[model samples]
Target: MTHTTRTNRGLLRGALTLAGLGLTLTGCTGTGDPAHPITLVVRDAALREIGADCAGATPYNYVHAGTELRFLTAEGTLADSHTLSPGVAVAADDRDYGEATRVPSLCRFTVDGSALTAGTTYTLSFGDRKSQDFTYQPGETAEADPVIALPPLGDPTTEDTD
Candidate 1:
């Protein structure tokens, strides 16, 4: 890579790292109170909303099926988990209010603990067949967007880490 390109890439990585550290200093996501309830919705490539995981002759229509979500504390403690599908309850768990969260889309995550942003709906997805998770913020909802675009898992240039 050229000197300028390499320098920019390094700077970008450094900025991302600092952003992550800042998020770590923040508290929980302020979502998922056990007393309250949450729900999930599934959509397809066509953005058709469905009541459950897609099945039968054309199962490709449902990508959210079989995806899992784990609500946790700021310290990575498990508050609750959800095997995502259409019309599934968010399974409110009083155990811990979510802080930071990991995503099923391997490398993707929300360091700011904004995955379950309240009163907002988001589409959670990565590559085809690689499911991701999101939440319908309490008191607000939206029609599911098409599968979202995210960075690839692991490093594309490297082989096995071992």
Candidate 2:
């Protein structure tokens, strides 16, 4: 073949190779919805203030009626908001933490899977407290629920020892 013809054929082959590479990368990242639901847990030691009544109590860390759980995108845009009911007493042994094993309750909530996009990072925030950034892997769910342990409310050393 002529030199010009040979050069054109080489360029075509390179273009095809690049196209195939792009397809392979896309497949690995997954193009479909997540396989499992996204759940987030917001834990705070302040729940112990609800008193020893686990069955009947609604305690707030501050003066607010309830805590606001807000989900934000990587770009810092608000995605959605959920209400975290006032504290309900829970067994300390059930959610015992290191050293201070007197914690009372754990706050839990689930996010709608349809609202989340695969391979995207998100942030869970409660009031001014923010959880670590997490991402839902492509084609699958997060390995575990994102548990945000909020800082203790008021004094940590002043526990009711009665």
Candidate 3:
């Protein structure tokens, strides 16, 4: 073959090799199943001060592709879980406030299993972990708050006493 034809063939072979490598890499990185459902938990001091109408003030919104679950505060409780379909926003509103307020700390968790799935439980306790408190106002949109960072798992000083 002529020099120009030979060079063209070599370039085409290199391009095909590169394309095949890219496809292999993409297949290896395919999206896997979610390990757990997204769990959001909020604690607000204002909810306790207010009465039943505002009982649902402290709320948690859990969402996945096709499932949207909500956990709102029940009377004297932190969360009351509810399962819902996709593309819906569940909220509890008793009154309207002019602006948004912040809660000191909000926690996000990844919980395995579904409402029907067995052998699953929720936990937020940590060694020497102190519960942080915050305030909330009416009509404010709920969002995740900063998490209080803790030391490493093996730290003796941080271990639970009881």
Candidate 4:
């Protein structure tokens, strides 16, 4: 075959290969829904349930309320943040994610050109506090529930122990 014809065939093969690669990358499992976005239900140490309306959670409220709840990738990339009551508001990465007719946005990531699956572990950060890295399952609640509480303010040190 002529050089030009051979080059065209080579390009076609390359394009097909790339297309397959893209499909494979997109075909992995993912954290679903932005509105029903995965939650990090924050409860006191007693699991008393702290919502966006926690009274004592002030100061730590603003930043701690909406500012907390950051979803970081296993590679520590900040994938998303959830900021509604119950905080940690993460929707899938879609522009219309918040709308009622939500497109299923699975929580997936690409690290170093590798597709990370949905059940892939992700870090949950509340302000400076971080929970153990974890993977999420669809329709899972306890996985999202975190018994997050701040240290008692101005408590005495060890010497004060009596």
Best by lDDT: 2
lDDT of each: 0.30, 0.41, 0.26, 0.35
lDDT per residue for candidate 2 within 56-155, as digits (tens), equals 1234243122456677898899776655443223332233365653554433233344566666777867676775566655332243422232322222
Candidate 3 lDDT by residue in tens digits, 75-99? 3233323332221111112234435
- By the TM-score metric, which is better: model 2 or model 4? 2
Report RMSD (Å) for each prediction in the order shown.
Answer: 16.6, 22.4, 25.4, 22.8
Backbone clash tally (model 2): 0
**Candidate 3, after superposition: displacement of residue 82 in Å?**
23
Judged by TM-score relative to the true structure, which candidate is superior, 3 or 4?
Answer: 4
lDDT of 1 by residue, 81-161 (tens): 555432211111112334523211111122122335454334433222434434434432121211122221223245332
Order of the predicted models by lDDT, top scorer first: 2, 4, 1, 3
Model 1, CA-based lDDT? 0.30
Worst 10 residues of 1 by lDDT: 102-111
Model 1 Cα RMSD, 1 decimal? 16.6
| lDDT score, candidate 4 | 0.35
Model 4 C-alpha lDDT per residue in residues 1-162, reported as the tens digit of each score: 212344444543343333223324444212222323332322222112211122223334433334545668977898766543323221222234343443321111211112224556667666677755655444344223212222212212332323
In model 1, what are the clashing residue pairs, if there are any?
A: 28-99, 29-98, 119-137
**CA deviation > 4 Å runs, candidate 3:** 1-34, 38-40, 45-94, 100-117, 120-124, 128-162
